[model samples]
Target: MLCIEDLLTLELFKTLPRNRLDWICDRSQILNLSTDEILVSEGDPARGFFIMLSGRMGLTRRSDGMEMPIGQHEAPSFFGEIPILTGDPNPVTVRALTDCHLYQLSSEDFLTLLHECRNFEQVIFKTVAKRSRGLESFIRNREKMAALGTLAAGLAHELNNPAAALVRALRDITPALLELQRMNLVYGQHQVDAEHTAQWIKARDEGYETITHKRIDPMKLSDREDELLDWLEDYGVEDAWKLAGPLAEGGTAIATLEELTARWQDDQTKMGTMGLRWLALSFEVMSMISSGLRGAERIAELVQSMKSYSHLDQGARQLVDIHEGLEDTLRLFSYKIKNGVEIRRSYSPDIPKIWAYGSELNQVWTNLIDNAIDAMNEKGILEIVTTPYSDRIEVQITDSGSGIPQEIKSRIFEPFFTTKAVGKGSGLGLEVVRRIVEIRHQGSITVDSQPGKTQFTICLPIG
Candidate 1:
């Protein structure tokens, strides 16, 4: 339960009208959280204010592979105070380090109360000062980390081409080895006896000739064996004595060296591709991956998709087909969706291309569809319908899952506003999506909701 004193102590509301303050306190609720429970997290939009009623609360920040503790507010203190003071997206995460009881004030009601009173402005100013210090520290640290991230990302991008080539090269090796193996068998069959092998040799050569004519000799087997052995040694094949007789008898032994070399070459290509991918991601988001488990490719890809979707590097917009951007984003998120969801796609034929930002638009689609899949827990129906809207195209993304609450529908577009569990969402996703659509693309997105039915309709001018 919220007490009048809690609202009374905060500087932001010191000047609020007594009646409005009373109204806010009356409406506020006390939420008791168990140990390790999250109260609020980074990227969740500023709701109102979270004041610690009792117990301890901790703020954690991710910096350079370390989870550094930022600030801990004990009972009678407030957290997420900065967002309420600044009315911006909350950048720091607040969690209950121990069992805690917190009084959550509605941003709307709190602001209404603040406006009605003038006596407490001084107190509000003081509290804002306290919270601002902590926020400044968090930002300073984050910016520094982001810088290191840029250098690393550039390095990753520079390495991508080689890696891509390696993966591509490996893909072609399977067929090459198969062709070589067939040649080996033909040579082995002719190795049995010289006179008896002549007819077999002629037939084998003719067969090989018909298929681009590669020659092999059963008698020249000695030379081939020497060549094969040298190649194997180069490939680290140490157990040659035992491998020799069978290989000589079957003529297919040389294929192992080829297979090993192919795999090795392929691995090089794959690893190189990863670096290039990270580099590409950095180009989009500009060092968003300086922190987190980037050693794991998931974080890298997340950074990549985020960067691509943001279009941070360029503000310019051009004509784009939302469907194309949507498809590209889907490829990025397919792994996550595949875990349990059966995706249903319904793209309209000849989806008119609209003027838009190619990458940022990708993010909007990615965030929306990703959320839909999550809403369904990766199962249930997800339909993306596109129809011509005279001068624009309208997209209706509906899912068979829990729908948004009517009360929170408006808040969903607010920056950092989220309804997901801690670590599961930044709450900034939809906020960013809406930003790109409305502000950047000069488009509109609306939502309608009911049980198991929520539709996000986006309209973008095609001309």
Candidate 2:
């Protein structure tokens, strides 16, 4: 049983004249909702209009298998008008926050009131517009945050390997250096002849040069190490096996070790053999230091790429080299692609810089490249082609994965539409790409696909 008095209590109904209010009360149905009850579900057919009478209701939209509250409705508030006006399904699920009373107007009656009352129509439509704008704003921000989270996770994973190498290098180098120093001090106390010392120094320097400058064949080095191991054991050098790897890596032949240890063999003490051991260990330490430096340099390079990709220290809009941005994004995503994906680049060497939002352009590249990697299931060839057009530059990213199906291609850029599994996508990736390319950079993006290949082309004006 619906009453005129209850209808008048709602702000939207208050604006309607007495006759219209009476008409609405007669056509409307009274609905009572218990706590946690569902009012309308997302994607459900637009049934009618609702005006809350008492208690509260919460609106939520599904993303990544979770219900995310996007808006709410309380007593005297109205909803369901948006879907009715647009003739579309409900965009959000509405559930009761508390036991509630509401008035539901049929689509026919809701339309009649919309047409017949000027003030009532104005208020309802305005509220619809305001709510729509607010929802859009909220979702847009959420999209950016989600994208940032994805990028951040990818960046952390990519940085970890090189960073760990750098740490291990630093940790191991100190002890090796100290051990080498102790060996040097022991040798220095002995009154060794200058000529013998010179011979030892020359041999040590040559081994270091060979190890640092020349790459040894692993098979040949293994044979050489075996020969040296047997020779050192026969000559009575303690733990001869321990010196074999370093001496082999340092290009120390059995002849070289035999000649270097000749003087110590006659001595009752094994100082000469000890010196040879120290020299091989020293060469090994040098190799470690070299590798550590390389790891540190790699870490520095990745950090710089991350900074450039984000344009953290740069202005919002600037003249940017498109290839630079693309490369930076590739570097950040390298961890994901490194296992099996092969990247091919074809850049027109002279492509000009373009004025744009540098970071946004990077985001565009990130999304497209990331999507391509996923499309390939992380094990196909990805090609980036850049061509200079008249007053613009065209960049294409192509992946050797099964192309997007024709039926869904047209709707791919629609917000919250995705082919990815639940919990793996928010469905805003391509929408963000479209907004950045078309709205932020004044560019055009187009895609072409087939069974084996899909290419996304972005054209940006040079001016």
Candidate 3:
């Protein structure tokens, strides 16, 4: 049974007059719970206000398909007010951590008392604000972590192909060089004729040019390989097919091979086909070096893009080039954007750098671009245009995809308001974007949407 002493144990109840305290005692119902028992679950309808007389309760919220502990409630505490006041479902689940006794007041009775006592209402609203801020803070951190995880995964995916190519090139180049060195030593033992050697060197240099410059037409390469194969076989070279493709890729003419090999044909040593073998191997080695260099360059490019996107070397606030930031983001998101999404850019080269929070401003871009990609279902044309003025710059990101409904357009920026399925969104992405733009940077962002086209326009002062 509820008593006056139990009511007085909480400072909040002490704010009420004696008659109101007696009224609470009469109206509140006694409830007992064992350890691990649930008091209320997340998303449950607002039942009433709860006053914990004894024991502790844990508060957890669901995020990304997992239950995360947000807070706890101890004995001599009160809760269940936020949902009741807002007339919304509970945002967290409260479960008893130990055997407990609690008093629950019906929603109507709690509201009646709330209106009757100004001091109590004041205290309740203040607590509500503090708790709301705490929850928001926790959620915002989780959102940042989730975003970071996504970028890291994309970076890894983008790095894989080039890294593998580099490894294969390094692995294959060593043996080819050793074989070429053996061929050169054997050829040095023969009678040295300056004119004949010059012919072979000239042929080698021309082939090197063809391979490095990719001068051979890919369509003609197969037919050329067949012609080389027929000549190599007639010239009695073993595994003639192996050398044919590289020889053809090097733009080797069958007539040139005949002229170069004419003297070696009469010789009865490995030198008979050694000159032809040397030319093909030389071309293959050059191709390998070119491929390896390109792969290394690609790796460097991706690393630099990620570093610039993060603004890791810069201070919190700095002069930022809008186009550079946008380009860096697109590079990082290339894995997502390349799957049938076409990007159209109309950047104003004259737009001046703006003094702003560099990393936070990038976050604004991240959220908006990420959302645009999702809205398009990863297959659409995304258009970005920048307009520069003397005092301000405007960026418009437009996507060809399903647009926001007219009725929900106004509430899209509200915190905790989202159209994404549960676990797919925290509902604070655009809200955070709004805060960074309007509140932090003193800029403004607006969205215009209709079926098949949605555009978000952001205006920021250049200072």
Among the numbered candidates, top lDDT falls to 3
lDDT of each: 0.60, 0.84, 0.89
User: Global CA lDDT of candidate 1, please?
Assistant: 0.60
Model 2 spans with C-alpha error above 4 angstroms: 15-19, 41-48, 63-66, 83-90, 106-125, 210-213, 217-221, 421-424
Q: How far in Å is the alpha carbon of 2 misplaced in model 1?
A: 25
TM-score of 1: 0.46
Candidate 3 per-residue lDDT, tens place, 1-463, comes to 7899998998888888889999999999999999999999977889899999999999987788888898999999999999899886777889998988999999999999999899999989999999988988887888888778778888899999889888988999999999999998888888668898998889888888888775788779999999999999999999999899889988999999988877668788857588889899998888888888888999999999888888888898888999988988888889999988999999998999999888888888888899999999999999999999888999999999899999999989987677775557777899999999999999999999999999999999987
Instruction: Sort all candidates by lDDT, best to worst.
Output: 3, 2, 1
* 10 residues in a row with least lDDT, candidate 2: 418-427
TM-score of each: 0.46, 0.89, 0.93
* lDDT at position 3, candidate 3: 92
Deviation in Å, model 2, residue 82 alpha carbon: 3.8
Per-residue CA lDDT of model 2 for 358-401, tens digit only, reads: 98898899889988998999999999999997888999999999
* lDDT (Cα) of model 3: 0.89
Q: Candidate 1 residues 230-277, lDDT tens each?
A: 654564544544334323333434453353235235553342222222
